[model samples]
Target chain A: MLRALRVASPLAVVALWQLASSLGVLDPSTLASPAQLARTAWELTRSGELPHAVAVSARRAALGFALGAAVAIAAGTVVGLSRVGDAVLDPLMQMLRMLPLFGLVPLFIIWFGIQEEPKIYLVALAVVVPLYLNLVAALRGVDRDLVEVARVLRLRRAEAVRHVYLPAVLPGVLVGLRQALGLAWITLIVAEQVNAGAGLGFLVNNARDFLLTDVIVVGLLCYAALGLVTDGVVRALEWRALRWRDGGETA
Target chain B: MTGTDLTTPVVAAAHGVRRAFGDHVVLDGVDLEIRRGEFVTLLGRSGSGKSTLLRIVGGLDQGAEGDVRTGTAPAVVFQDPRLLPWRRVLDNVALGLRGPDARARSTEVLDEVGLAGRERAWPRQLSGGQRQRVALARALVREPDLLLLDEPFSALDALTRISAQQLVRRLVDVHRPAVLMVTHDVEEALLLVDRVVLVDDGRIALDEEVGVRRPRRRDDPDLVRWRTRLLGLLGVADA
Candidate 1:
């Protein structure tokens, strides 16, 4: 019964929404009924237009997220481990993280032009700060007793990292990945709206010009679905990697 | 050289070891020597620099001014069982070991430490005594010439502490490493060690040999006398 209620909750919301639209509590031109949104989504899917836009957006998000995560890990490792790296890089990073990331979109467009490069760069820039900050904090927070044990065990530099530091920092890194994924999607949406020639944001904007509210709703739902799917993936990774933690829910 | 007592090899030795932290001095011209198969306990108050000396001998810190020489790399067990939580019990024991035989060696040591068939258990799943047993297994797996223990059993409850102490005594008899344990517990020092070196004000204040026979009772007259004497040195009013 509880499981059925879980499924029914969303259905009930949609049913009420549909009823409200039919009763003219919501204007059809401004807010489409769930039925109209479903029909538009089905038509877009059948015509392959929705899928194509999704593919483009997913490609951009994947490329940008990967690049951002890789650099953050590398930089965070260096800064967290070495005194010189912290002295040279940490203040600069802290300063840069202070500027609102959304405000950088215009600067990125001016620097990289209004091509796909700017969109991808915007997502990377937005995602990098959270990942780097989280990873650095985690690395610094590794148990001092464990590190001392590694030393007493006579673990060399590389062995200490493998046996001690990496595992200690991994849960935090996964948390950073979740935060960065959310930020990446938000940045991608704004970037696409500001300058993209194609993608889901493009679909939403195109529908808005024609005042097709149902199509707009479908595009927004796709974005929401994508966010949930990516978050689930990160959560699954956290579960497997941090299995030793009690209750197994580090994320 | 002391001609009368040079038969057993000195496994670990410190010559005039001195350490100071800025204005405060922790260890002042402390010297120690441990022979092969000897169990020595450095008994002291909380700030007596016993742990500092252990760290220097363990090669974890070398900021002090002194000569510290060991026959082989020493193994240490800290107050807390510092097992890597991500690794299983077997892997934590095998942490210092390398090569393909690490697993087999770890398995053998776990069995010897009475934790057989618990290889897959995480550190958090084990009881406090069990975790310390894992730590002892880790140190013993190295077959260290000198085992430096820094109050390794202080965290356990009284009964668990006794059992863990018995485990250490049994393992010491079997492994025969030159052990240097630092602790404030006078009874613990008397029960486990062959020699008790009272450390105070950064120096060895007393070095007494325990001549009590094996499997001796806690109420034994000689053991009680030594315990009272050691507790007095620890500044306790009564035994």
Candidate 2:
């Protein structure tokens, strides 16, 4: 019943939107009719333009996200494990984290130019801080008793981390990853819109310039769909990794 | 599972141990010794430092002004069970075993604790007593020379506590570790431990040895007398 409601509610909204546009209660020029938007989406799909644009944006987001997450995990683990690492990195990380990603976009563009590099760099910067912060919090959240048990058992450093720390922090890290994915997708769209060539964001920018409301609507829908797909993938991975936690109530 | 050689003398000792946090003294100038294979209980009121002393002896905390020496690493089971939430029962038990043979040893210990078929269960899925049992198994899997328990059975219900107490007694008899368990319950201390050490005002108030045989009955005359004595020392009347 919940699933059916989810499907029905969206269809109802689309039907109301189409009826309003046809009755001139809503202007089709500013707010495109559902049929007009669908026709434009179909045209873009037929020409293979939409797929290419989507693929470019996805590739950039995927690469940037992977790089950012990897670095975050490594840095977070080091800071989490040692007092010296925490002392050295935490203050600087805090300062960097407070600076907005868009605020650094111009600096990145100045340094890396109008090429794909700046866009990727912007997305990476946008995603890394949240991932790192979440991972660090997760690592610190590990139970002290568990760490003591590892010490009493005489487990080596690597073994202790693998057997005790990693499993404990995984759920928190997944949450951070989900948040970072959303941020990365939003950042990618904005970054691509800024002096970019051929991506979904570029399509949206061009459509806006020409007052092509249907294309703009299509671009926005694509962004939402991409966010949903990425989130779904992350959730699936989390479910697989944390199978042991299924029957247990979360703390 | 053989008895201690009886000639090994003291397996662990604390000399002039004193611990303080700022203005509050938790343990003050305490001395303790545990003979090999002896089951000792440190019984005290909540603020009397029984748990603090146990932590110092277990090497989980450093005392401010004393030396502690133990021949082997001492494994501890806290009052809260403290099982890692993300780990399976077998994996939690396996945390105490190192190197190549850990998995097999974990399985054996789980079996020994009567949780053989529930190795794959998570800690939260288990009842309070069962989680405590897993904690016990983790400690036992290491075959430690010293086992320090800090009010390990205090969280269980009456029947479960009794059964777990019986299980611990049997395991101690078989494994023969020098065990030091901290508890607030005088009856439970008397029922499980061979020697009872009472702590009061950051000092050892009483150290009495129970000379009873294995499978001690709670209603035994000697145990009853000892319980009465211990209650009097704690300034509480038996109900």
Candidate 3:
């Protein structure tokens, strides 16, 4: 069955890898054995190095994401609602969206210096465009008839947004959040690992200099864990927001 | 039906209304009015500008060159229910109106529409007929002096349409909001409205009052005769 193979294949690969390490076919310094990586991870956890690095990375990602998402949502709402706002902000966003954001790492380093500022700004820049684009597209796709219904009811400006536009654009906003969060992690990795700083990426950089293969693998695993956790949080928010799609009153 | 006459206050009126999409005209210098407590239906073929004129009178169309006046914003029940899928029945019904009693009034309207226990239900959970009922409830909750129903029941099944029609008839009688419904169904036009106007060539081809009383059967002699006349006016030769 596919279910069993899905579980067994990864285990088989790990077993083969450990066997190769024991037989000395693989260099322990170049690529750590599964047992060795696990041992180093345990040691780092006890010594508090891994935990401290994770905390620092989490703080940077959270701050950058919060800043980016807030500004993007506000800009998107303005452009989507008013024609005047659309005229000014929409063209600017269209041009900005095409910027190869990851390629700005060097420029960011120059402007913000090789510190938390560069890393955080890199993450922030990477996230803003996609969320803004998705929110604007969602607003454009709202049903014309629904808009007419609002006009017929003569809803006030604020009331129309609350009753019509907010819920209409929510699914798109949530989708954009997931995408932006993934890109945030990838950008953080690039920014931190390439430059001087403290974080998971710094840990990876330090391990490479010392040739500690086990520590490097542990740092990579930490990145994967943080990414999954952030994505899971967004998914939970999505379920709560769109409960009207399937779940009933009792549910 | 409630003694509508020339002296009754007009809830909505449009004079010399003209609208065109580039070279093609949809409504051509049409004039119409709905008196207080009266139900009027515009019967027309597809693309005959019936819906366009309704939209113009309801303030949804601004391209028309005309003098249009109406009381407070008309409550509209569009062909598609147009319920907010994310909003619960209660929230949807309470959409425009404000104040603390909004929810309580919305609940009362929902109950009147036979959706008494569905306040917390999402629009997606309801059947087509139930959703239309919620749309009606939403319109009625506003307590507008003018009500617009744009083919509101046309999308329902035959049996469901009959019940929906009856519900509209019942509500109009109770609330007495000046009503204008657009429908191609001749029988529906005759069965529901105090006056029936036939639209042809982007203009009102025929407008007449129905003398038939309420609680009348579909097979009643007067409605049958009116149905034949209206269908003929709508360009159906053999009815």
* Candidate 2 C-alpha lDDT tens digits along B1-239: 22334576887889999999988998888999988888899988889998888888888775457988864868888888888777788888887465798999899888988888888888889999999999999999888889998888989999999989999988998998899999989889877888888999899998767776656788999889988988998989987
Best-to-worst TM-score order: 1, 3, 2
- Candidate 3: where is the Cα deviation over 4 Å? A1-12, A19-25, A82-91, A247-251
* lDDT by residue for model 2 (A95-179), tens: 8799878878789889999888988887887788989999999999988877877776777898887888888888889999999
Candidate 1 lDDT, A1-251, residue by residue in tens: 99999999999999999999999999988999998898889999999999999999999999999888887888898999899999999998888789888898878888999878988877887788999999999999999999988878888888898989989999889889999999999999988888778899999999999999998889989999999999999999887888898733321
Worst 10 residues of 1 chain B by lDDT: B1-10
- Please compute DockQ, using alpha carbons, for every candidate against the native two-chain complex: 0.52, 0.40, 0.60
Sorted into a CAPRI-style docking class, model 1 comes out as medium
Please give the range of 10 consecutive residues that has the lowest summed lDDT in model 3 chain A: A242-251
lDDT, ranked from best to worst = 1, 3, 2
Write down the TM-score of every candidate: 0.95, 0.89, 0.92
Candidate 2 residue runs with Cα over 4 Å from true position: A18-39, A78-84, A248-251, B1-6, B22-25, B99-101
Provide the TM-score of chain B versus the true chain B for each model in turn: 0.95, 0.94, 0.97
As a whole number from 0 to 100, the lDDT of residue A191 in candidate 2 is 92
lDDT of 3 by residue, A56-134 (tens): 9988898888888887888888898779999999998888888888778888878988878888887887788889989
Candidate 1: regions farther than 4 A off: A22-25, A247-251, B1-5
Error of 3 at B216 (Å): 1.9
